[model samples]
Every structure is written in C-alpha cells, then in structure tokens.
Target: MAAISEALTLSAGALEVVLAPAIGGSVGAMRWHGIDLMRRLSDDDRDAGNVLGVAMFPMVPYANRIAGNEFDFEGRRWQVLPNNPPERFNVHGSGWKQSWTVARSNAGAATLALEVTGGAEPYSYRAEQAFAVSEKGLSVTMTLTNTGPVAMPFGFGLHPWFDRDRDVTLQFSARRFHLEEPEGVSGDPITLPPELDFAKGGSLPGGWRNNDYGGWTGEAIIRYPSRGAGLRIVADPVFKHLMLYADPTKPCFCLEPQTNASGAFNRGRWNDPDEGVIVLAPGASAAGAVSFAPFALTFPAA
Candidate 1:
C-alpha cells in the first residue's frame, strides 16, 4: 500500500509538490498558491497507494499499449503479458507499477531511480526521474538507459492528470492525429479535424476523447479561468507526440508528453521519424525534460 508518511514534499514560493517515490514514482499532489494544479490524491487513495488516483506518474521504456502483448525487434520476437487486466494487452509498461528508490533528494529537488532486468516486458533498462521545483515552476527530467545485452526499441513519457474545470481551455499544435480503435488501440494517422484541432485553443469536448497527436510542437497551454491562472507546458524536442484524454463523465483529464506514438511498436513504424521511436543500442540512453509554468490569466476588460 502507498503510505503518505513515506512521501517527500518540495516547495518553492507559491508552488508545492509531493512525490510518492515508492508508489510507482508518482506525484501525490501539485499545488500552486494553494490551488491544485493537478488532480490531488485523496487521503484514502494515498494510504492505499493507488497510482491511478495520484496526480501524475511516469511511463518508462514506453507509453500506451503494445498490441496483442507482443512485438518483434532485432530479428527476435518478444512477448509481454497483460499488465492491465480486462484490456487484453500490456499498457504503460511496468514503470508505473514498480517501486522506485530515491537516489538523492533535497529541499527543492529529488531523483528517483528504477532498474528492471528480466521484467514482464522483454526489455531491460534503468529509468530515472529528476524532479525540481523553483519559483518559476516544476520541471521533470526523465532518463532511460538500455541495460540489456542487445539493441532494442525504447520510449518514455509522462502521464499527468489535471482537474477538469468547466472553464478550462487547452491549446497546442500538431501535424496529425492518430485515430483510436476499439479498446483504446491506436490506429493510423489522419489529418486533424476541425473539432480536434486546438491550434487556436478551445474547450474540452463533452464526450470521450482519447487519441495521440503526432508531430507536436512540444508546447501546450492549459488555462483555468475560474482560478485566474494557467499552465504552460514546455517539452524537449525528443518528445514529439502529445496525448489528450478527456472523458466527460470524469472530473479530470490527461495531457501526456511522450517520446513515441501510442502504438508505435505495434504499428511497425520503428524507424519512422514521425512515429518518434528510438532504437537504442545496449548501454545507450535517451533523456528529455518537461516544464510546467503557471501564469496569471488576463481577461479583457472584465
């Protein structure tokens, strides 16, 4: 179970971040000036160590699903068991379900590390998350190193859940949208539709929306007019894909920044630049960072 007593807290100015390293390296909560920037975990969930209830979590080795729980790489076929049940496939890899050790930490920063060799997934790698909070905002740098004996395809991403305020607005730029098949599988890419295109900023849809945005600009803005504040997401170039997930029946939504597409492994687009897959040889590493900066929202002559 996840114990809040073991969680670490970091604060700077009006921002505060609580990290539950042992709880799948997830963020228990994030607040700015006492306003929840992300979905805050409840005490019951915290005590239960429920990752799904946390504010955010890390997706290592890869993100999203691996169709049929199998794939081929380097002339070798590999298979992963169904990690998330009732889904019929492996989703989000194993990082979010494993415990992480705190390599180092201080008042304003912390680094949590995990090593997986002979895990459920046919990949062996070491992952680290370095989180730092400053007066400006919070920044998380994710690093993944292949620790196996051979080359392999790898990817990493961050999954953050945000509160779905009635007046919240989102904006970002992407070249194409990966269509969604049944059971949340990612299909082929298609031109962005008028409603799905957010280059000009807009409100969340009233229905279900779970899709990946390829060729992302690596930046996004989410505004909460009710709180008079907004957050700007700046990601590194390595993260070329952005995923938006919003269910009207839920009280929260997700904006994920990842290195590869939702089903790049299954799509067989390993070397496709637009798919954002990284073929890393043994001992090679890939790293990137994402920053969240909050700013005051300005209304016109309100």
Candidate 2:
C-alpha cells in the first residue's frame, strides 16, 4: 500500500475541492463561493483520517451491501466477512476503508489510485479517482479494472453527503424503486410509491429513506434554498441506479450514483439490465464520470 501523508487541494474560479487521498480516496470538502456544496469534513476527522466523516467517498469493486456477506459467481461460492461491523453485512467495499496513492496532481485536478488483492474479500482490482474543480463546480471520474485471474462481478459508485438544509429539495427520474429489506439490504423492485417518488421534485422525507431507485436517468438536481444555490449532477450512462439515504435523525443526507443495484450480486441478476452489474474479465476495465455544476438561484422580493 502507498502512503499519502497530506490531503491534496484543487481550486478553480470560485470552486475549491479538498481530496484526502489517504482516507479512501475521499473528498474532504467542496465549496463554491465559500458555501459548502456537501457536508464538510471536519478538521479533526481529516487529521484522524476518518472515512465515515468524509464528505464523499468512492465505492469500488461493489457498492452497498452483500446479503450474508457472501455470493456465488462462475459456478463457485465466494464468501466475505462483514466489513462494517454491527451491520451483519459487508457494507460498501474495501476501497472506502483502504488508503490510496496520489498518482498525479496539478493546480485544478488530481488522480488517486488504489490496488487491492483478495485477502478477506474475494476480488482483486485497481481503482482510480480523478478529482477536478472548475469555475462551475467539481467533477470526479472513477475507474476500476479487474486484476484477478478469473471473471467476476464488479460494480462501483460514489457516495456523497449533503447538508439537509431546512428547505432542501431533490429532483430526479427513475423507473422503479428497490424496497428496503432488513439490515438495509435491497429488496424487490416495485412501482415507485407516490411518497418515495421524486419525478417532478420534492423535499427530503421526514422519516427514514434508505432505498435504491433503479433505471435512473443519470441526472439529478439538489437545491439549497436557504443558501440561494443549487447543484446539478450529471453522470455517464453507465450509472444506472441511485441510492437515497435520508435518515431524519442525521443532519445530512446521501445521494449515491452507482453502476449496480443494491444487493445485485446476491440476486445474481447478471444479464438483467436493471441490475447493472458488470461482469469484468481479467484485465478489463469500467469507467465513468459524474459532474456537479452549481448555480445561483434568483429570488423575488419578499
């Protein structure tokens, strides 16, 4: 494993981004005109290298949870231990907990890479995250390549935490919703209920909302009315699903863009278009980019 002792910074125009390469290739903070676009990672968390406190982090090899911490592929059974303890399942993947090396950096962009071999996990791969900032906003491109000897199922995504402003509103389109099962695992896909639907746009749910929206259109808008700004997320077509986590108890919420559905591996929906799980062969790679563009909102006189 490579070590990156300090966090890298990228700045352009009014946008500034802090990348914590050592902390799971996570973003420490992102600000546009001094207004936080996401939940800012505290200085204490940055010094301690706490990934859970990061504003955003990469999810490579896979995303979300694996039922029973095990799955079968290619006619063979593979098992993995619970990565996130007390949850009873492997949440996210090894990438978010492992250190990444700074591959390249400049004034407005930096790339961090990580290499992993099957240890307690059953997959080996190389992942890279390219972070860049511009006058508009920030962009992150994540790429994952299988380095193992056999074909295996792979997935990747980005988990970003945003401040749940009192008047925050979210908008996106999806074909259906994945029901939430016990332990927060993804259940069956069903008709998106009216309460969970955000087709036209709506505010965050007052109750718990940990579910996945399948058949995502790869675009979303998040408005922070109190801040007088909004963010637009545009992702590559490869990202077919989006996960929304809005626990009313927390001050922040998460909107994740992922290539695979939650529990896709457990369901073995390899050929299913809705699952979005990629079967990568040895030395194969999958890459995608997600861009966040921020704009100021104009309001009428009170």
Candidate 3:
C-alpha cells in the first residue's frame, strides 16, 4: 500500500493552505497574509488518531451525534461505537480518524481520497476531498459515494476550528434551531432565542453553546476586531445546517457547515428536506463545498 506523505502545501496570491491527508485528511494549517485563519496544528496533531489537534476535518456518511449510537434505515439497524470519550454516543462518522491518500496535488490545489469499507463502519463509501485556493479565498469540495450493498442515510460537513479572540463577531442567517438535550442529543426544534441570534453579527457570547441551526441562508461572516481581519463563509445549498460551538473559556471554537441536523440519523424523518438528511441508494453520491475568504476589517480607534 502506498502511504500518504507527511504534508502538502498549496498557495495562491495571499492565501496558503497546508494539508495532512495521511493524518485523517485533516487540514494542518490555513493562513492569510502569513497569519493563521484556522487553528494551528501541533506535533500531537500529526498522530492519525488525535482529531482534536487538527485545524479542520470532515464529517462524512453522517454528521454529529447519533442517539444511543444506533439508527434504523430500510428496515435494518446499524450500531456505531462511541467514537469520542466521556461521551457515550458515537459522534461524527469514522472518516476523521482514517487516513486519506493524496490523489493529486499542486502549488494551489489538491485532491485526497478515502475508501471506507463496510463492517469497519456503518457505511461503506468512497469519499473524496478537493482543496483549491485562489486570490478570492480557499474552497473545499467534499463528496461521498455509497458503495455498500444497501441504501443508507448520508451527511457531510466541514468542521473548522477558528481562532477565537476577545472581540470576534459573527453573523449568519438561520430561521430555526435544534436545542440539545442533556446527553448531547438534539431535543426539538425552536425559534432562535436572543442568546442564539446572530443575524446582525455580534461578539461571541460568554457562555457555552452547541446547537445546530437550520434554514441557513448559505452565508456567514466572521470578523476579528483586534486583528482588523474577517472571513466570509459560503457553502452550497446542500448544507442547510450550520453548527456553532463556542465555549466560555476556550481559545478555539468551531463553525461547521453541515448537510443535515445534528441527530438526523435517529429522527426517522429522512424525507423531510428541512432536516437536511439524505438517503442514498447503492452507487449514489452526494457532495457540497465550503469556502473561506479573508478580508481586511477596519476597526475605529479606541
């Protein structure tokens, strides 16, 4: 077997992106004007199993937690192990922990591939990731093809760990929200509360929040007041759910563009488009892209 190399670097104009496909296809680093836009990776991150050390990683076949670690589809039940510790349920699918092979690469673009077989995980699919950078920004396209013998549920998302600052602001459109239960499972849908609303883009709150927002308008903007820089986030319509994870005392947090709700697997509402879930027949495929563009943010004098 040909193994993945240690690292691959790509750049265009003022933007640069480093990838470590060998380490679970995670992004090792992303920068703008030599300043990191995503969290920087460390030596521990280079280890294949340390997903938290990654700047960004893909959630495939399905995204987020599945209640009780099991789901039913087409009259069959599938069980997934607890992928994360201190959490009894399986979180995010198996891809982030699996190594990916580089299919192609260049100065400003690259493509990586992972072939996941059944039995090893719930879904057997061929997943691919394409990264391209332009003066405009960095764009990533992720695709997953059902290669198993039966039909199954599918979802995808890009989990990017943005560096948090004291004066960071965020703005996005989401008509509804899925509040999580105590066990980290989504309880029910509700209107956006005052604490959860960011339609006008405000500073990240002083509390912890981990919820999935629906009815996304397909765009978001994040600005760092101190750094006087910002990033524009845009994703294809396949990604209708936006997940924002902010902790009161964390140096970094996540802004994820995902295809479905947090616990779409156990909801059994696969036919509801608003839930963002999709059913793929054998050999069928689904994909979408997420882009990040950095721009100058002019802040007035104190």
lDDT of 3: 0.87
Model 3: what TM-score? 0.96
Candidate 3: deviation at residue 3, Å?
A: 4.8
Worst 10 residues of 2 by lDDT: 1-10
Q: Each prediction's Cα RMSD?
A: 1.9, 1.4, 1.7
Candidate 1, number of clashes: 1
Candidate 1, residues 59-165, lDDT tens digits: the string is 98899998888988767889987877778988888899888988888899988889999655578999999999999999999999999988888899999999999
Q: In candidate 2, residue 174 scores what lDDT?
A: 91
Clashing pairs in 2: none
Candidate 1, residue 160: lDDT: 95
Q: How close is every model to the real structure, measured as TM-score?
A: 0.97, 0.97, 0.96
Global lDDT scores for all candidate models = 0.91, 0.91, 0.87
Model 3 over residues 83-169: C-alpha lDDT tens digits?
888889988898887889988887898899999998846789999999999999999999999999988889999999988888888
Q: What RMSD value applies to candidate 2?
A: 1.4
Residue pairs with colliding backbones in model 3 are none
